[model samples]
Target: MKQKNKKNASLAKLTQQLLAIDDSLTGCMRCGLCQAVCPVYGVTLKEADVSRGKIALLENMAYEMLKDADGLSERLDRCLLCGSCQTNCPSGVNTIEIFLHARQLLAEYKGLSGVKKIIFRFILPHPKLMSFFVAVAGRLQRFFRRKANKNMGMFEFPLLRPFAGKRHFQPLAAKTFSAKYGKINTSAAKSGIKIAFFPGCVPDKLFVRVAEASLKVFEKHDVGVFMPDTMVCCGIPNLVSGDYTSFKRLVKINLDLLSQAEFDYLVSPCATCVSSIKENWFRFRKDFTDGERLQIEKIHDKTVDITEFLVDVLNVDFTQSANAGCTRRVTYHDSCHLKKTLGIFAQPRKILKNLSGLEFVEMPEADRCCGSGGSFTLTQHALANKIGQRKRNNAVSVKPDIVAAACPACMLQLMDMLSQNGDNVEVKHVVELYAEQLTVNS
Candidate 1:
């Protein structure tokens, strides 16, 4: 009887907290503009899958008209949180913020699952331990995964199919980027600019070559690089999972490590990490101590996507005519966070266009979300694959020899979509293509 009473009290407290965001919830115009752009709604064709539907549910719950928080959470989880709806909303509803906060509130009310608790709290916050596990998985992957496509670096894991579901994925690196090159601190040369490099978790572990390419670009531009061994995951995974405790802890860890280094800007090859540092970090500034908040603000100001850093800050010229000597055609995919959140669609295209041997072709709907919303691909696998197939169809429609994206997560999705179809197109980062040109010139 006492336990039941305590549970009801906790539920009542959660209801009160939900009411706090009522003003933001009321901002949704319900004009259904989000339906035009929402990738999940496009796939599911369900009202609850769109932002407006979710907002309506939130409003009802806040007003005590709805008692099924779990059902509402399921509806919220169906979204990609790609910020597409928010970007296109007529009323400028803070869709992402409201969804994220609602998720956090619901998570608190229901408590995190054991698996998520382990991943967000224990594994992610500890870089070395996470690295050790990935390294082990890398060695054992060959035993479980058979080569699906050699050129695309894809493998089919029959053992993981129950969980992963016909997913073809890249193998983990034998050595992460940080393990290979520990803690670099170089002075600025001809460019007279210094930057702290944040090779996001995916690039560091799954796509070391991309991380290497970023370094080569930095060196070619004469920009100083500072990469500390201490930096871990950028906390987006935690934040999106509604594990605010883990998210704040990860942020503090990164801020403390980054504060030790002096640089003109903090640059990352991952669009999500750049967005998290710039936009998401500031969203919760009030929760931090005064000094921590100041640090967060400074870091937020300094953070830039590597493509943006190159073209905007370094002023690298990409205007040269395409060489007739080489004829590899490349198409660019605009990542949602890169384009919608950061407004960095053009800089990557400019970099692609300037490459000596590659011809830059624009893919149809290049700015569409590739459906790899970080963990969204994992939880909502079927919906993610459906949305990814649309992106795949758009890429192939351009008939390019290679498809490139500024974000590593997009590259992973593109690789999967193209490889599954046995398409002959190569997937690469914009920097990798640019780095090849630098090598040719050097």
Candidate 2:
């Protein structure tokens, strides 16, 4: 009887803590406006899939008897963390912050899953181990990788087919961006802006060319480059998985590494990485040491998407040259982080619209989530594909020869959707498209 009372007391304590963490949700007002914007809710139509529904569940879990912890965690994980609900909320509820809070709280209560623990704890924090694994994976990729779509650059891992499902992905690169470039320290001859390059996970491993193109653009515009060696993965994957311990450790690693150097801005080809550094770093600021918090603030202020850098920082003249006569219809896909979070809409569009031989067409629902919420795509692929197919149809409806996005992750999803549908459209990073024009003009 005493032991039972002690257990109940502990459970009550945990529930109270969870409720305190989720108190930001009190602003929600049970508004159903989120249903119109939530990608998963649009597909599932389950009240449990939308933000209000999840908020109500969280409220219940905090106050009511403890029931299905696993079910609650799964419901929280159903979201893409895409910020659509927050963006659309008339009452201005911070749904992203609330959802992240719910995820962390529930994951703490239910405990991290086994597979996620290994990846988040052992694999992610060590850059050396991740690089070593990337090297080994790259070397062995050709053996397991079979071409699934040629133009789309997707492969099927037959050996890991059971784990990979029908999700076609670009094979790991033969060499990482760091391997090719090492660490570069170059001064601007004219542009005068110095940027520390963060070639995020996808660019570092799967799309080295995107990193290369970003470098090329910096050089062409006479912008300085700082490619630091000590960089690690941004903590988005860990944060999304609700593994705050790993997330904080990775943040410290990155903050320490970046503090060693000085630059005007930290530039990344990956919009998601920039968003994580800019917004999420601040969101989780309370968890850092005092000195680390200052560094996070300094670095956060300086992070910018590559598209924004080219047009805004370089002050690239976009008057549309007289000989800018040649044409191909290019539609731009707005990365949710870049668009909704940062309000970086016109800069990328201006970069695309200014391309000498390109005609920029706005795809319907251009700002829709590409369904690649980082790990969300890997875990919930069928639902992701369903959302991605909508994005794909919108891009193809414009009959664009090229679909451009500022995010590599979005590029991957767009490729999969377009390839699976046998569409002739090619998806590319907006920076890559801009880089192509720079090279031709040069």
Candidate 3:
């Protein structure tokens, strides 16, 4: 590999790597169809705002039309990388890969912020230290947060306003799931299949009860579960931020933890974790040694989103008579990782449909990005909130008693959006609903 030129990195080389985007880009045909589906482009009509425009920009970079590396990076980071454009693209260009690689290159050049370096590098790697901080944060949340909007779950932190901005957020959990439930080994139920559960950081830390609900569901099905005492972050947060090195470390840690276990499938309530393990690991697995690579492939092969596992793997059935006088109308929001990345839009809905007393209503644009792109929300909050408002509107339009999603990060975002909007819609994990349906007698 040539030394990456601090001043004049070859745009041609960068473009060549980008163009080799798994033939997904080959299908794009420079179609402008993505422009209609892009939320950022919807907000900004700049040619660089749409996927076609960005693809053109990258192509121009290959031919040397776009210079100013910083400017190009800014344009690249503008994307939510929601895969909305790829899903909508007539050519089916792998815009997600292009933007992610582009961001990595730019971050390598421009360098990450000191805060990011500290957070991703130091904190995220060590779940124990991270849990401690979250514990304190949860205890002190009331002192720091002032009601920003009564209905939207919006809160303002006067001290951290400069960094966090005026937006609402859920308070961190006092105890992370990993801390509370160190390791679990449950016997298979009548189904006679075992799975290892990976709840990722957000669900484990912020929404601990969701993980509990998952355990409950597994017990109900008589499905066994294996959870290692120590699991690392899922690495999507590190990967998307252009820190492949840290991402690799996290992947290795997770693989090492679960590699010693015996389970039929690796499961997660988090769509991002399932996709990251199933997809991104393979995409970057080449960097590892043969031994590690084999382990990576094995995990990837076994990985399944929780809903997919419930509906597909265990053959859980959701079609049943609705509970008489069931009053709660629940709606499902498809996390982009589940719907777009893994093509798992229906199974979650199917699981939601099974809840006896719950009315499963479909929201408009049920598959749109909720703008909780992990660190994307933290860094580009204004843009994130703008995208989230659209999601909030769709959910609100349905007037759901509660909102359900496969990803905890999406639940966090939905909770904030609904809270800020002053709507009282509770955000619940799909597994939680399934757990509730388990016949205690069975």
Candidate with the greatest TM-score versus the true structure: 1
Residue-wise C-alpha lDDT for candidate 3, range 1-442, written one tens digit per residue: 3465633456565555556643344456875888888877776677788888776676555333235766776677677778888887766567887777766756665678788788888988887888888888889888877876665445767787565456677667778888898888887767788898998888887788789988888777788899986787888888888887788888888878887778888989888888888989988889998999998888888899888888888886566545435678999999988998899988988877767788889999998888888766766788888889999999989988889999998998888777777777788998887776675324
> Tens digits of per-residue lDDT for model 2 on 257-359?
7776678999998989999999999888988999999888888888889888877777778665422765788999999998999999999888888778888
Pairs that collide, model 1: none
lDDT of 2 at 47: 93
Clashing residue pair totals per candidate (backbone < 3 A): 0, 0, 15
Q: Could you give candidate 1's per-residue lDDT for residues 21-55 as a string of tens digits?
A: 67788777679999999999999899988988888
Ranking by TM-score: 1, 2, 3
What do the candidate models score in CA lDDT, each in turn? 0.88, 0.84, 0.79
Question: Following a full C-alpha superposition, what root-mean-square deviation does model 2 have from the true structure?
Answer: 2.7
| Evaluation by TM-score, superior candidate among 1 and 3 | 1
Q: Which portions of model 3 miss their true places by more than 4 Å?
A: 1-28, 60-67, 148-155, 439-442
